[model samples]
Structure formats: C-alpha cells, structure tokens
Target chain A: MRGLEKLVTGRLEGVEHGSGVGMDALTQYRNSVKERLDSADVLVAKLVHENTVLSQTVETRTQEVENVRHQLKTLQNRVAELEGREARQEEEIEIVKDLFEHLCGVRVHKSYEDDTGLWFDASQGSRNGIMDYKLGFVKNESSAGTEVVYVPLLKQRSSDELRALQKQLPGYMFDTLSFPLKSLYQFYSKMARSLSKKIE
Target chain B: MRGLEKLVTGRLEGVEHGSGVGMDALTQYRNSVKERLDSADVLVAKLVHENTVLSQTVETRTQEVENVRHQLKTLQNRVAELEGREARQEEEIEIVKDLFEHLCGVRVHKSYEDDTGLWFDASQGSRNGIMDYKLGFVKNESSAGTEVVYVPLLKQRSSDELRALQKQLPGYMFDTLSFPLKSLYQFYSKMARSLSKKIE
Candidate 1:
C-alpha cells in the first residue's frame, strides 16, 4: 500500500511539473519512462526468483523442525523408562548387599571392574559351633550344569553375654563346623522329631 | 536478464513496425506506452516490498532451526548418558543377586514396586551346627541411630555323607547354636590363641 501511495504521489508531481511541455519534450519523456519501466521489470523478475527459492527453503526447514520435535518426544519417553529401570536395579543391589552383610557379619567386596567370582572373607568371623563358619560363592557360567549354593545357618548372640557365660562356666568349648545344605535338611528333620513336648 | 531481453525485442519490433508514422499516430503510441510503463512500475514496487519481507522471514526461520538443532543435540547426549547408567546398574544388580543366592543357597526376591523393608525367609534351611540360623535385614532409616545387624556363622556339609557317618558311628550327633557378632570376634581371636602350637 505504501508503494502504491508513492506511485500516486509521483503522478501528482508529474501533473505539476509536466504542464505546457513541447511535443519534442513529450517524446523525450516517453522514452525516459519506458527505460525506467524496462529496468524495473528486470528487477522484479529477479526478486520473484529469490522469493520463490527462500519460500521453499523455509518450508523445508519448518518440516524438519516438526520431525525432530516428534523424535524428541519418543526419546524423552525412552530416557525416562531407562532411568526408572536403573533406579530400581540400584535399589535391589543395595538391599541384597545389606541383608547379606547383616546375616553373615562380613562385608561383601564386589568389584564391577571384573565379573567373575563373588566372595566375602569369613576367615575373621568363624568362631563357634553356631557362629564359626566361612562362606564363598562361585559364579555359575553357562558351561556349568547347576547353580551351586552353600547355605550356612548360625544364631545371633551378644558378645558381652557370651563372655559373661564363659566366665561362669569353666571347661566349655565351641568350634566352627561345615555342612552341606542337604545335611542341614536331614539334621533339622531328626532334631524336629526329638523336640521336647513341654517346649512345644 | 530475460525480462531485459524482452524489452530489447519489443524495441526492435517497434523500429520495424513504426516507420513512416505521422504526429497524430506517434502521440497515440506514446500515450499507450506510458500506460504500460505505469503498470509495470507499480508491479515492480510491489515485488520489492514482498521480497524484503520474505527475506526477513526466512532469516528468522533459519535462526530458529539452528537453535532447535542445538537443543536436539543436547537432549540426545542426555538420553545416551542415562541409558549407559541404566545398563551398568542392571549389571550390578545381577552380580549381587547371583552371588547372594549362590552363597546362601536361597533365591533372593526383591520387589521394586515399593520402597521399604528387605527380607529373605531362611526357615526352610535352618538346621545343624553348620547351617541352622535365621537371617533378616531391616532398612536403616535416617530416623534411627545405628544400622542394627545380627550375624551368624554356619558350616556346609553333605546330608548323605552325614547320614552314612551317623550310621557307621553310633551316638554321633550334630546340633545348631546361636552367637552374636561380637562374640564371634572374641571367640575367633581366642581360638587363634589355640591354633596348632606345632604348625607354626
């Protein structure tokens, strides 16, 4: 609209300036106008070409942005899913390690740098018939037939109480013992049969 | 350039067709040419305006696309990092659980659906001097002062071998007992007192 307004202004100026011109001057004015129009036409064609190319590029870029946005949404969901899985897995490791240490009285040393045997040094804690056992766990490889397990059962007691009992009772002795899981099953079954009826 | 070429073509045609023209005919031709020039000038002005606006829009759109691409790169890296963390956490859980089950001879059941206590039932395996204790772990809440832990030590042996030994040796016996972690430390230290006086 502004360009059109400028055109109107130019026409009004032409009315004021172009009055009483000779025929030769009119011929000259006509030539000048035609040359100006020629150059303007050329400029217009170039502008049209540039605009066409720019419009196409913008359209393509906009589409790419939309596609990337969609991809971003999918990736966001996947990242959340993986994060949830990781937190849960970390919690499980912490729980199992805590329970193992609480029950066995030995710190488990697991090095992620290497994946081989799982071990805890019970050489320090083995003491009595009930709390004097050493334990170790071997990995079960695919080549192995069955998952090997060694279960040891011992009771929890206070060190101070045991010391007090020992001072009162002379000539008492306790020792560490080893037995397979199956031995425990048989031993307990036999003992259960001999349980005192009064205690039951 | 092609628009300029068309102008040249029109001028050559004018030279060929406008020969021997009178003043009246020339004036009529000039006016007609002036009208065409006015319309062409208007079109040129409109095109220049459109091209300026289009160029500005394209520049802004290009900058937006660049910014979006940078954000996409950052998000992609975050997704990859989370995935790596998840994989490592998963591997640690597998390693810990496998080892715990192998050493304890019991499957560990961990439920991540809730966050509270950690538990394992050893009622089935508690028997004998070597493996007759129960083990359970409680979470260490910040509200509590100390992480309370109970430890028991038991040995491993084959049940069939024990049965055979019992049959061969009359009045042989095996039994389970309980003791505290501190008691174990004292007892083991004392036993280290009795380790073969000759073996050294």
Candidate 2:
C-alpha cells in the first residue's frame, strides 16, 4: 500500500507540469483528476463497441456491392437479347408490307406519300372474289348475299372505257363498296400514339 | 503540497482492495496501475473518434432509406397506370372478337387450340387473297395490260351458284378461299407474345 501511494504521488506530479498554478488550486486539481478517470473508463467501453459495429457495417457494404454487380450483368444480357429481336421483327414487317401491297392492290403505305408504286387511286374499293368488270371502273350493284367478289381498281380509266366495263359486267358490276381505310388508319394511329407515349 | 499527499494516499487506499498481506507485492500492483493510466488516455481519444464516425454513418443511412422510399412510390404509380391500361385493352379485345365472329362467320380462338373454332389452318388452301398463292389461280388476263384486283369472299354458295358466279366474273378465279380467321389469330398471338416477352 505504501508503494501504491508513492506511485499515485508520482502520477499526480506528472499531471502538475501543464497545470502549474491550476495544480496549486487543490480543489480544481482534484476535480480535474476525477473527471479524467471517469471519462477514460467510458471512452474505453465505447471505443470497443464502435469498432465492432464498424466491422459489421463494412462487411454488409461489400456484400451489397457484389449483389449490385451481379444484377448489372443480368440486365446487360437482357438488353442485348431484346435489341436482336427488335431488329428481326423490323425486317419481317418490311417483307410482309411489300407482299400485302403487291397482291391486294390495297397500296398499304406506312405514310401517305408512298402512293406512286401501286395502281390504286383517290377512291378506294375492295372485294373478296372473282370480278367481271374491267379495272378502274365504278358501278353500283346490289350484293347477291355472296360475301366474295372480285374488286378491280380502274386507274386513269376514261369515262368511255369505264361506261363500257360497267355496261358489260351487268350482275358482276363495278366496285362501289368502300374499303375500311378509316379502321386501319385508326389502328395504326393508335399504335403510333401508344409507341410515342411509351417513349415519353 | 499537504493536500496532494492526502489525495495520493486516498487513491492508493482504493487500490489496496486485494492487498491483505503487505508491501512485498506492492511493486506489481504499481506496474498494473501505470498500465491502466496510460491505456485510459489513449482510450479516451479513441472513443471520441469512434462516436463521431458512428453518428455520421447513422445520418447517411437515414437519408438512403428516405431516397429508396421515394423511388418505391414512383414505381408503384407506374404499375397502377399500366394495370389500368391493361384492363381497358382486355375489354376492347373481347369486343373485337365478337365483331370478327359476326362479320366473317368464323369463331376466333386462341392460337394454341387445334381444329376447333374459327382458327385459321394455313395447310388448308389459300382461300383468302392475303395468302401467298403459288399460281393455281389465274393472274392478269386483260388484253390491254396488267390490272390490280381485290377479290371478295363468296359466302355459303351452292356449286351451281358458284359456277354461275365464275362465268360472270373475269379476274382471277379460285375453287375456294378461306376466311381471315388466321390473320386475327396471328395478330392477337403476336401481341400476347410481345407483352409476355417484355414482362420476362
């Protein structure tokens, strides 16, 4: 106990260096020493806990980084696949469009400006079966309950040629039933609007 | 100085808890006392740093949680909008299906079913003008030049009526042409396939 008393005296002496006049104030010196001792105990315990929590946080962050990298790789692969499919579909649509224009004389155009290639004109007419009239002539005949009939588009036909074709055809007659151009136009317009909306 | 001596003695008294014998073991106790004092100084500084770092980390995590919550809200809104559009499209498709059945005398079914409903079978002859006919039907037969024709589908015609209709008409002739059940099936199938693919 005497040795411990001597040791404490030595520690107090060491603290006296910067304290100087403050150390001479006995009450102040005593209070300062007590504060330092109590603070040191709390500091040690708090440091140990913080170290543990920091290590756990670092581990969790590393795991999160790895998960994000894996997701990025998966998303990149999907984008490549989708781009390839979009290219293929665009090609198929072009081929189908050409076939439709050639066989149907419908002049299926992506835009209104593409009208020079086909034989159809300002007035549109369509039929579903064999026809007797010459091309590019207009006539009115009651539908005979037959759903299929030939529709011939008489492009640039003179009034005389049209009258002859109409007179000769009789029961078969020239086409006056209007094609459902409005329905098709609406469908495509809606499709375009929807696509634009998606882009936005 | 007198008070300092008293303070030192008081501290040593607290350390003398295990000293039942005498000053023979006091040197070891003094060494332990020195180590504890030195460790306390360092532990104090370390605790301040740890506390500062922990506080900063907690603030950052709170902000991140708030940002994630905002993003989730945006995603939920987008999902709700898409669900609404999907419901409307479903109703429109049902109405269109009814119209097609009434107008074409063919029942529309999902593409997967076989030999049932108004499903178009491509293997059956190319009855519609839409199909690619390899040359069984007559092509541009006018003496003047090639002409574009739209053929209508003949409905429920007897053999005699069909023969008489053929004599009256002049463009391409067909033994039979199928209704456009397959086209409608293809359109819906493509749409469903595209949407499903997008979801995946």
Candidate 3:
C-alpha cells in the first residue's frame, strides 16, 4: 500500500497526477491516493500513542492524590488525640491545685511574702519598720500535706499588743516565742493542732 | 484527490469491481476512492477529540495531587504545634504540683487520710472503740489554701494513756476538752501556736 499509489498515477502524490493517455493517467492518480491513506494511518497511530501517555498520567496522579488523602486522615486523628489528652491534663492540674490550696495554700491578704511565711499579714500596716511578726512553715517533701503557715514583717510588738491580738482572735494563736528554734517548733505544733475541731 | 484512486483502475472498492467499459468505470472508481478519503478524515477528527479529552483529564488529576499535597503539609504543621503546646502544659502542671507538695501537701505517713484530716495518725492503732482524737477542717472554697486537716478512729484510752502521750511528745497537745466546744477553741488555739520555727 505504501508505494502502490505511485504506480497507477504518473505525476507523484506518491507519483502525482500525470498527463498520460487514458489508463496510465488513472493509474497514476490511484497511486497518489494510496499514499494519502498511508499518511493517514501514521497520523492515527500517533494520536493513539498520545492517548496512551495521557491515560498513564491520569492514573499516576490519581494514585498520588489517594496517598496524600490517607496521610491527611492519619494526621487528623493524631490532632484529635492530642487535643483530648491536653484537655484532660489541664483539668487534672486544676483539680490538684484546688486540693493544694485547701490543704495549706491559704494566703495572707496583706502579707503574702513567700510560700513558707507571712510577714505582718495579720497586723495592720506597720510599714517602714519591722513591727509585724512572721509566721511560716515547711513541708516534709513534695508539699501535699498539713503544716502551719504563718508570716510577718518589721518592728516588735509590745506585750500589750500581743495580749490585745490574743484577746481579739481568741482561737487564733499569736505567740512570740518562735525566735529561738525550740519555741518555733512548739509554735508550729500548736498552730497545726489549733485549726481542728471535733467532727461531731 | 479523494476520488482519483477509484478512476483508472475502476473495480469499485467503494462501489465493487465492475466490468464496465472505459470512462464510466473510471468515474465510478474515483467516486468510491473519494468516499474512502472522507472517512479517513472523519476518523482523524475523532482521534483528535479523544486526545483532547485525555489531556484535560491529565491536567485535572495533576491539579488534584498538588492540592492534596498542600493540605497534608498544613496538617503536619498543626500536629507539630499541638504537640509543643501539650508538652509545655504538662511541664507546668508538674511544677505547680511540686510547689503544692512542699507547701502543705504532706501526708501523715501512718495518718494517710483524706484531703483535710489526720485522726489517730499520730496516735497508735486504737482501731476498735472511741479512742483516737479527730482533727479536720474545711477549705474556704475551692481548696487551694492553708487549712488544717485531721481524722480519727475508735477506742478511748484511760487518763493514764493521755498523760503518757502528753509527756512523750511534749509539744503534742492531748486534751479531752474539745467535746465541750468552749474548751475546743482553747485547745485549737493551743495547738496552732506550737508548730512554728524562727528563720534565724
């Protein structure tokens, strides 16, 4: 079929249209027609080839999309898990803190000095001088227990002032003997026990 | 050009080979050849259209892959951020808990009781009848403060046992007056002042 068109036709398409006598001219024309058919075949083959390549591309990209989607799903699950864990942890922290506060976390209104002591917290402003007494305590270790907490700051109070306070807050202890370590122990022991009452 | 093939060698590929004489046969052959060429043209057009569709599909799929990849990256970053936050929050919870422990979270080793009391914790196991003293206190509100906590059990001991304990732990107070309420206040006042120590 490739060169058949050139045979029948004299003037080349393969052998184009010729000015020959009757039969010869017809043959020449026929040959050229065959050539065109051959070319068309080739064109069709190329198009089919291109189609194959395009199909492959679509397949590959579709797979890639699926893989990425799977990855996204896994990440989403992880985020959900972490959010749950964080929320629970935060809540637990708050609960423990609450318990700690009740145990001995009570802070002095005006005398919030440190974790262990309260200086001049009870007495009114004796500012500029060491007039107020200090009250404080320490825990055995981690800090989830019962121990007296007290503090003070500036100036010494006269026996009169001490007696007055003792009279005012009868149940509240305001002893001044803690300066000497021995008295301090005695004061702590006393403080711890004073806050209790019969369950009945 | 299309009908040329059918002319000279007229056999009627489009019309069937005929035993006609000269010109008429050639004319008929040419016509059939033209028909074949037209069909070829139509086939090429169809192929081109199919190719275009394939190209469009490839482009769409490629874009989908890109979009999915972008989403995956964003999700990965979110996971990272959440992990960091959770880590920091967990660390903070631990620190606050440590501080609380040191403040007043101390538990009576043997006195291991509720959040607010240590009954026969200091006293030995009088675990049968009305014996050990009770000690407890409620927090002002949520529980993040300094308050005394105590508990107890049964079995009352004779006055002899009380006197013995008073001497053994000199600072530890042991009074049966709490039952009367008036003496209860006095006992508590006595108790709270005994646990403090001087900073010096």
Candidate 4:
C-alpha cells in the first residue's frame, strides 16, 4: 500500500509538471501573437502617415503644374498679340521709308546705336551754296517730345539757311523741328520744293 | 491506498483538461494573429502599389511643369524680339507718312477694307480741262505684280490725259504702275512735278 501510494503521488506530480510546461508555452505563444499584432498596428500607422504626406505632396505638385500651365497659356497669348502688332508696324515702316527716299532723294538708314531713330545724309545744292543736311529722329522723355532734327553740315550757312527755311515753312517749328510724325511728309516736301527753287 | 490512487487520477485528469483549454486558446490567438498579419501584408502591398503609381504621377507632373516653364521662357523672348522690331517699324512708318503728305499736297486716309493699302483723292486743273486722280497701292501676290493704280474720275479726259501723262512720265510703266514700295515716293514725285508743269 505504501509503494502504491508513492507511485500514485509521483504520477500526479508528473502530470502537474507537464501541465505547467504546456501552460507556459501557450502563454508565451499568446504573447508573441500580441506583440506581432502591436507591430502590425505600428506599421499600418506609419504607412498611413507616409501615404497622407505623399498625397499632400502630390496635391501640391499638381497645383503647381496647373499654375505653370496657366502661365504658359497667358504668355502664348501675349506673344500672339505682339506678333500681330509687329506685322502692322512693319508694314507701316515700309511705306514711310518709301516716301522719304522718293521725296527727298535721301536714303534713310536705320541707326543701330539709337533705339528710336533713323539717319540720312543728303546734299542740297542751291544758287548760293550746297548745304549738307543730317536728318534724324531724337526721342525725348515726354510723350510728345520726339523731335525731327535737321542739322546742316555747313555751319556758316546753317544759321542763315535755317532761318530762311524756317521763315519759308511757317507751318513747321524750325529750331528743333519738333513736329508730329504724321506731318513729316509736308515738312520734307516743303524742304525739297524750296531747295529745288534755290538750286534752279 | 485506493483513496490516494483515486485522488491522483482526478488531479491528472484535471491537469489534462486545463492544458487542453490553454492549447485551444493559444491556437485561437495564433489564428487571429495570422489573419491580421495576412491582411496587413495585403494592405501594405496595395499601399506600395498606390504609392508607386502616385510617385510616377508626381514625377510626370513635375516634368510637365518644367516643360511648360521652358516654353514660357521661350515665348517671353519671342515677345521681346517682336516688340523691339515693332518699335523700329513704327518709327519708320511715321517718317514715311510725313514725306508722302508733304510731297503730294494731299491727305492719305488708311483703307481699313484693304489690309495693305492707302488712298488719296486730288483734282489737278489744266488749260485743257480738270482731271481727278485716285491714287493707291494695290497689293499683288508676285513681287512685280503690285501696282500703284491711278483711276481717273472723269472718263472724258481719261483716254487723252492718260496718254499724255504716260508720254510725259516715261520713267513710269504707265499701264499698271507696278512699282516696289521703295520706289513709290519717286513715282509720286514724278507724277506731281509733271502735273504741276502741265497746270502751269
């Protein structure tokens, strides 16, 4: 009886020991699962945050691109308008150059150094003397300040001829020749006619 | 001894039952963890794909914006060039218009209906009769085809005066007066001088 009691007690203790080991293993596994879940939560949170930032970045970039496109369109329109104006202005310039050459017998050359001017050198022979004229446009600061300058190369005759020419052509303001561009044809015609009469 | 054996057996059975319950809980927890991990993998893969596509979109958008900026810069340069040319052309036109008005002793009105033309009306009186002249530029497709048309208002003097004028101005090709824009001033000067002699 004593041996049988000892054997039964040993078996019971062994079973209890086995159960403790199994419970510990199960608890450890459960802890590992909980840890994995927590890590997944952290990863998901990090990924969501990163995605949100990326989305915001994309949105900003998209808006910037849109703005750039809009600006490009506006610039294109401006270029078109400028081109149209340029065409018309070019045609007008051609006509004006033609008239100057024919009426004054002067070849006008564009002044590269001057932004808003042209230059012509011509000799007008008269009974008294031959006068050399340097004609051009000079821009001033004011809106109507642009002047047509006629500088006689012959300094001696300049004063007398200029005075006479100014008197003969009463319509023109002689000292600086501050006349409108539209009336330039009339000024040149009078100059040509008066100069021709003197020469004849 | 019998009582001790029974007690040991009961303890062993209870331990076994508790271990089974613990193992079952562990399996359930592991399964839950596995499910969560699988879902997380799928979510991560989806997010990664979305991010990749979004990154590509952003890259493409960035490149497009850069292209637009380049275009805008190019267009701005074009506009500046056009503006410069326009300014020069405007100055030239102003000079030509002035010369035409002075030499012809007539006012030139811009013909809006004609894109490339101007018109003038004048009456010249002679001992024989009075003749009305309509002078203008007529654009032609070919270089030599463009002509300065002089239409007589009075049909009676048209035949005789046209012949006499043609004979008087031998330099001019009388039929069409097809002259270059540059030569227009010379042609008009000749016409005016001849007409003035005839009138005198």
Question: How do all models score by TM-score?
Answer: 0.48, 0.36, 0.50, 0.53
Error of 3 at B175 (Å): 22
**Residue runs of model 4 more than 4 Å from their true location after superposition:** A1-28, A99-118, A121-200, B1-19, B22-32, B95-134, B139-200
Cα lDDT of model 3 by residue, A1-200, tens digit: 22333332324222123342344444545555666766767777788898888888888888888888899899999999999988977765555444333333232223233665433233221111112434444352544543444443324667765454444332434433323322443443333333232222
lDDT accuracy of residue A22 in candidate 2: 32
- On TM-score, the candidate that comes out on top is 4
In the order shown, the candidates' DockQ scores are 0.20, 0.09, 0.28, 0.27
| Candidate 1: tens digits of C-alpha lDDT, residues A91-181 | 6776766555544333454433324443333311222222222343344465353322333332444776345334432221233333443
Candidate 1 lDDT by residue in tens digits, B1-200: 34543653465346335654344544554444454556666776677778788778778877877887787788789888987887777777666655544444334544323244333433112122122223333344653422333232224447763453344322312332234433433332222222212221
Give the residue spans of candidate 2 off by over 4 A. Answer: A1-38, A102-107, A111-200, B1-38, B46-200
Q: What does candidate 4's lDDT look like per residue over A45-136, in tens digits?
A: 67777788788888998999889889888988988898888877666555545434443454444433356675555554334334456667
Worst 10 residues of 2 chain A by lDDT: A111-120
> How well does candidate 1 score on lDDT at residue A112?
30
**Higher-ranked by TM-score: 1 or 3:** 3
Ranking by DockQ: 3, 4, 1, 2
Q: After superposition, how far is residue B174 of candidate 3 from its true place, in Å?
A: 19
Give the local distance difference test score of model 3.
Answer: 0.48
lDDT of 4 by residue, B48-122 (tens): 777788788888888888898898889889888887877767665655454334434443344232566665454
**What clash count does candidate 4 reach?**
6
Query: Compared with the true structure, what per-residue lDDT tens digits does model 2 show for residues B37-142?
Result: 5655555566667767865665565455455555555555555555554554454344333322222222333322123221122111112212112211123244
